[model samples]
Target: MNAQSAADPSAVNRFLKSVVAWSALFLVIVLLAGLVDPRYLDPQHKQFLFLLGFIGMWRYSNAFMHYCRGMYFLYWKYPRMRKQADKLGDQALPSEIYMVVTSFRIPSHTTYRVYRSVFEEAARVGVPVTVIVSIVERSDEVLIKDILRRHIPDGAQVKLVIVRARGTGKRDGLAHAFRALSRQMPADDAVVGVVDGDTKLLPGCVANAVKFFKLLPTVGGITTNEFCEVEGSELIRQWHALRFAQRHVNMCSMAVSKRVLTMTGRLSFFRSKILIDPLFISDVEADHLDHWRLGRFQFLTGDDKSSWFSLMRAGWDTFYAPDSNTLTVEHPPEKNFFKATRQLMFRWYGNSLRQNIRTTKLLGYERLGLFTSYVLYDQRVSMWTCLLGLTVSLVASIIYGAQYIIIYFLWVAISRTIMTLAYAFSGHSINPMYPLVLYYNQVAGSAMKVYALFNMNKQSWTRQKTTLDSGSGRFDAVLNQVSSKIMLFSSLCIFFGAVSVLIHLTQRAY
Candidate 1:
């Protein structure tokens, strides 16, 4: 079984209730539109549908091309590099390493497992590694200490340092721990690792991942592939599995260019020269983005993006391990699946968009390389394009009749199936529900990205329940919320209006 099937027996064994209800509503609307119209087969309407179809095709075609390109690197190029690293064995590893594991509001059992795995890897690597444990509780510190003592190999130079943070959030916690980690004065050639509290390192994960840094002198940072252990329904597990599978392909694609968008915070390693620098450490601790409306608000999440931005500006290349090397324990912040997923996407995409704006202006095609810059630019436009199929189809459905809607749904089903089947080439197990899930991810994810793009300063932590203070009065907060909604709603109206004009349906002739 591949990493995908290992997540659960298939949360998608049953269909989504939302899908059923949506289909019912759509059928009802289609019927109404059909009954009210008699020109569903008009040639002008046909011309409009044909023209609008191209936009949907354009967006999906780009994705298909990316998948094909990504598959070539993932299955072909990456394996060659992996075999070369495997042959080098321990020779490819750093001389000495420092790993900082932050444990804040994470379950104690998970904290123990994470530390134990880190210690075991240290012992296996047989290197002198100093682990800095950042914790908010005394119990986890004591627990990690016990784990370290038990896993230290005989005669191995395994050292541990514990730092307590103010517990404001992960960014603050990492700043506290990293400042201490820098104080240890690791060697100039050493490697520095950052591990989140909920992520566990797999066996030999450190050696496997860190070796890439030694192999590629240009690489300044490396993050490993991840599989999630989700605490939710089978559907959620499958969603996580599908997401990881997609991430693996995307990472491999970006790695070939030596520039991944984000070096994941769950488990990633950096060159000591970069992380140990005081300025670099400070960026991860309390980074802020300047925006026109959001103003200059400090980041409350996405420490990972901050690290990647610093690397980009400093001219350091970043990529990922060719192997799956970590397991993230996922707990949905809410019980309702839709609410939980939206919350997660808000934070995840919000990070990318927040950093995306700065990077767009900071590093253009000249510095960021050709394809990398294009991908970043696509991140800005893809949200609008993603909504085109549904938006155009729904508009046409309401006018030209249900036939248009039916035909649009057929295209969506067929297109998404082709997209999901392409994952088979990615070497991950394929699920029957993947096509449906992929559609949901695109539509819902695009919606979430649009919202996050507008509300960039709305940052928060799920486990910590921490948010950006804003430091504004209650009335000011209400006004800001109203302004955000108006902007989002107005932009969407403009988008729909543009589509209506393109289809020549502005006159609403039937």
Candidate 2:
């Protein structure tokens, strides 16, 4: 059966399954409420009960939306794309492809693997491929070139260009590579693929992504589905796996609307002409946002966000390819789980918050479309909601006995497990550790978002030994720090104060 014909029945089945799954989730919440407190469902205490209901419903509604969108993509969008891509089947297109791989202090083994995968895919595509190896260390040039030479298939039209940067950051290395590619004056129809040093492209990834360019002229960039090879404790491995699972759902949801938030730097394909724009390199390398409270600060990380924003501003659509996969070699930044995860979150969320503010300001409903715009706005609101739920529950537990806390934990466990099971329908297997990791991401990750928002100027490429200062003067830096602390203090005070008032009112009602 063809792509469209196959998608029809699967779509209906998925829709029915999603409805059943979500309805079951709602039932679970109702049962859990009774288990926690018989009065929770009692309508007699409408005021307090309504408040509690709103909190629970809001959280579950968000999850439900993601579930629905994810199912839509899994049952319809991804399967359709895969079938279409299969029909294309390694047929060489008219345009050349320039693959740029940027490396900075990557392990020798990882570098070899990345290069080998790139060359192999390039040969399979049967098109003229220019591989740009962007690096900082001069010593590694021989090693990288040797790998490239060994991997390049005989008679394949592949050219290797090695551009050395100042060892600054990935952004700088990318800038150098783009400039070099521009000098080559590749055809407007040609495509550019950017893969990080640690990422290895799966077979057919390049061919699959390039086909999208022909399918959609307005598409400026596309990012691949990513898997990982993490070397760490089981906790760390599960943590990474859980994150990618969540990312897959979110990416698929965004892809349906053709406005994926970020064209992930790990493996993204772009129209070669986009790179030729004179200002493109500058925008990617030195992108900054003028925060009203934080002042003007250059982004320290998140090159992916900058690139995505640039494309959106230039009126280009970004997409996610669920079929195209890349394996990222993941190494924990620090051995201590908490410390390692915290540092990673700081950079990840810091970039996200920075992009969120700027993107919403620059292009809202008109440019981002309805769904994408709403998702952008939701990012800001979700941070507070996640934290507020925790704070209120903790305060209520303190006032009404420890069972409230225990019951809250039980509710979280049940809710997140249900969400994970929903994700399994999208091809991810259920991991026993997912529930714990889910809570960690919601609670700890939300806290990090707060910090990242205030400290947007502070950034570090954790893997690479480089840090970018926000460049604010001493006085301004100190002021930013103080302001952040005050904001946190004020938020906590407001939450607890509200809970205190609620408790007092409940006493009066009794």
Candidate 3:
């Protein structure tokens, strides 16, 4: 009998839903674009709107090009890496594995779940595992031991070492724990993981990821795919899910180049050789950046960025493992929807821009690979590019008519819906409201990035409610503030001036 594979009902249903969603959005765009009569458009109004239209076309076209390349790498090249990795996985790895779990002010249940999964997966890996649990309270130490007692498979070699930190920050915790692991003098091919307390490992997570170190000897570290379980409403769940889905695309695309932008703090595996280096330890512990205006300022947040920059400058390649996946337990700072999301975006994008600046200076087509370097450079421009279209429309609405604003709103709705539908392919649950939130993430996230670019020294931990001491000499601090404002204002003015010239609205761009 000839049998054919049947289509998945859920996938088919999702496809149909996407079709209907786009169809409706298109209709709305058509109606909105025609809401006002052409007679109402003055010469100046027409020119501004036309320039704004060019911006939209240019931005979307560029996005389409990048997305196509991303799809090519994700579906085509990544499988090749996985196939080679599988061959390596079947071999007996003589090297041992190590992990450093940093837990501070985390819920008891969450800590238990993380360690349980870590140990269970450690057992599956069938290797001697050394876990350094960095904690402030002794209760977490006791909690992890109980999980190990009840859950560790028989004959599984698991060693537990507890290090109590001052609860200052995750960087300090990771620093002490990682240095402790380094002092043990693990083998050259040994693999070590940096796991956040809030991140729980799934079965096969560690096993799937660690083999890559042996497979690609040049690889210094790798971060796994993350899907989040939010401790908030369903709205926040979808928001977090959307983020990871997008991250999957970017990571996979960059992985094709044998380089990824960041070594995420959540769940990353490193080569013991990289960790044991005095330079690597110093970067993670007390890394400082020399800014042109700000001089040398110690990094207050973004320990992950420091680790990644260390890898980059040290000439080690970083990668993303799609099959290796973990669950991130996210706790939004507060209940208020807007307030919570803003704080998160502010932190996330700020870290990105801060890293983007230093990373960009390393840009060379041959050095970083063409695609990866382009992606880093794009990150700097994207914060502003993402806002330009909307800014133009709003300016046009004030100078021209309310219809321009209405039409732009409809354009955003339709375009974002189409974009969100494409994200469904990443195996995330898609919500209708994702279009709205996606727009919010782009605009709000971009604004925060710009702000962070200027105020690079000011940083705060969202969960711990702690801030670095940003105090400096009063005269120098005032100069920094003034310089930041001047740079920000000048940058925006130059951006607007260039846009104005596109429609012959201003002579200044030339």
- Residue range with the least summed lDDT across 10 consecutive positions in model 1: 9-18
Which portions of model 2 show Cα errors greater than 4 Å? 1-49, 82-94, 501-509
**What global local distance difference test value does model 1 have?**
0.81
Candidates sorted by lDDT, descending order? 2, 1, 3
Note the residue pairs that clash in candidate 1.
11-234, 11-235
> Clashing residue pairs, candidate 2?
none
How much is 270 displaced in model 3, in angstroms?
Answer: 0.9
- Name model 1 segments beyond 4 Å from true: 1-46, 472-479, 505-510
- Give the per-residue lDDT digits (tens) of candidate 3, residues 118-152: 88887778788898889989888888889998998
Backbone clash numbers for all candidates listed: 2, 0, 0
TM-score of each: 0.88, 0.89, 0.89
Give me the displacement of residue 335 in model 3, in angstroms. Answer: 1.5
TM-score of 2: 0.89
lDDT of model 1, residue 311: 91
TM-score computed on alpha carbons, candidate 3:
0.89
| CA displacement after TM-score superposition, residue 291 of candidate 1 (Å) | 0.9
* Model 2 lDDT tens row, 75-186: 8877887677567665536469999989988888888888889888888887899999898887678987787678775688988898989988888889999999999999
Q: How far out, in Å, is residue 256 in model 3?
A: 1.1
Candidate 3 residue 488 Cα shift, in angstroms, is 2.7
Candidate that scores best on lDDT: 2
